[model samples]
Target: MTTGRYLAAGLLAATALPSAASAGVTVTGVSGDPGFLTGRIIYTPGGIGGNAGTTSADLSIGRMKFTGFDTATAAALAFNTYCIDIFNYVQNGTFDLQTFTLGNAVKEEQLKALLSNTAGLIGGAATLGGKKDISAAIQLAVWEIVNESGNNGYSLSGGLFQVSATHGSAATNARALAQGYLNSLGGWSAQPGFNFSMLSAVSPANNQRQILFAPVPEPGTWALLIAGFGAVGGAMRRRTRTRLAYA
Candidate 1:
């Protein structure tokens, strides 16, 4: 093969390799403070005994902003994420981005359904109360899908995965709303252009894992990346030709 052809092939191979960006993530803060439901989560394996129970303080349910480096450009990337692990705590620390398939098949399917359909329901709400209620419900639904033991279905009451609030009707309403979303998943259709990622913490081994959603890059974006590689190969070939002429 000619030198130019070899250099072009090398550039293509390099672009096809996985990104070498650092996996460190920092939880900046909650996104929009949509709202939180006041309740305790009961899971035998999540460090909290089924008898003792744990409140929202222990398992915070809400959208959070996470800052990390882009896998391709290594640029600062900040996006919204939702907690998927009730067994661990969320702290400002380091985390690694993993594939979404790390969880059970049921968990993955249910989460995709929730995010695709019910997650954006809050955007259509008319009042602050409505928005907060929808946000809390989405979070509750996510918890049920991730931590629930039996694949029977998702629920916030009377199952291996349970959420209860002893104080007011807000929690109760949120639970009902969440259950509605789960029930509708039977006929849910998969949506395209959505990319899901799992953010697993590096330290504090017990830190919570989060789900980050990003839109897939457009065709134009891919074209630009390919063009960039072509430019680099062209520059190298030009330099090689100049050296040969001088020789």
Candidate 2:
């Protein structure tokens, strides 16, 4: 009986452990100074008890595909940080983000084709690109435009990254995404060529303002936890009652 009880307790503990999920966003050649550019955003959704949305390999990643990164490497962080800054940098040019209009596939394709060439990027030309595919196809496009236009602070070698955003209320998603990126920075105080000062709204100087990276709890995680706790408690109570009866 004692052995059975111990086994039950162990099972409960295992069931209560945290959970994770996967959400993928693919972008390429982001634009900015010191951009951690990429074509793929490497992320796995996760968190501790009561919170586990996702964790990214880099907060933002860039176009270059260098392998064998030690999670602690500055290059890794540079990639993730690029994802965070891409949005703000994209619109710095004379071209408005909304210029990517609906039903204008030709211009959108032109924009994509134009930005694909890292060697020949020119910003003024991006003013012609429309916003029809703004959210979906524009990540790399934005980086290309911004960099070509000299809109952001990213150096010539550092203007790209890939990042992702999953589902949630806009605010919750922002908070979690920003928090997730910040957390990914881990204990490192600096990210090589990347500038932390640019993140004025959520930097250490500003006490890390919150944005919605909506961290939804892992599916079935909460239910399993509750059931496991109840099971453990019930077993404990039953053992106590049994002892009392014998006494």
Candidate 3:
């Protein structure tokens, strides 16, 4: 079978299996894709209270595409994800996918709000530049929500989370864009069809935790699918019974 076919078959099989505490996954860079943005970010030293005393470094942001095999069955699985932990870096190697919990209720709620509301801004950008801007902005917002302490509310220009001005207009504009999105969270309700799962690396404790976004079937839609499957199964059962009787 072709490599793509093998990957598809493996993914299908992997999804059928029960969820494991940690699945081995590998992450690599994605090039030539508008969905993934490449840009430099510089955080001010001691700017975020939670990440205090850490020196700033030039970092890139955007959606990460990863491909790996299931630990139990060796089935191939691939997906796009975003970083939630800015303190750690992503290495190109196998990492175990572990369930992540924010522990802080406020941070968890805010992150959910950001993911539910701003997903369209990233997905629906009309141009590559626009998409990159939104993608960077989302990453900034995520970092602020996850890492910032002392809770001055989420903001890129001020508060516990702040971006440095040395990285030029790209970094400046991204922070501003991110702040705009954070401001819109007030009175915003969680949107349907948006589901999020957090993944962390088990072996290397320092690897960044990532978030996966997926579209979920609505309750009504799932009911229809279940009914359709039942009808097909009944027809097959009836066919088998008739064939046995005739024989």
Candidate 2: tens digits of C-alpha lDDT, residues 160-241:
3223344212112222332332233222232122101111221112111101111123543211000010011011123322
How should the candidates be ordered by lDDT, best one leading? 1, 3, 2
Residues 15-48 of candidate 1 have per-residue lDDT tens digits of: 1211336544544322224443344555544333
Q: Which stretches of candidate 3 lie over 4 Å from their true place?
A: 1-24, 28-54, 96-98, 218-247
Which 10-residue span in candidate 3 carries the lowest summed lDDT? 224-233
Q: What's the CA error at residue 75 for candidate 3, in Å? A: 2.9
Question: Residue-pair clashes per candidate, as listed?
Answer: 0, 49, 0
In Å, residue 224's CA in model 1 sits off its true spot by 25
Evaluate residue 159 in candidate 1 and report its C-alpha lDDT on the 0 to 100 scale: 71
Question: RMSD, each candidate, Å?
Answer: 18.1, 24.8, 16.2
Which residue ranges in model 1 land beyond 4 Å of their true spot?
1-24, 28-32, 44-46, 49-60, 67-76, 217-247
Error of 1 at 222 (Å): 16
In angstroms, how far off is 229's CA in candidate 3?
A: 40
Give one digit per residue, the lDDT tens place, for model 3 in 92-160: 334554444577776666766776677566557787777667766766666666656743356665654
In angstroms, the error of model 2 at 27 is 25
Least accurate stretch of 10 residues (summed lDDT) in model 1?
Answer: 5-14
Between candidates 1 and 2, name the one with more favorable lDDT. Answer: 1
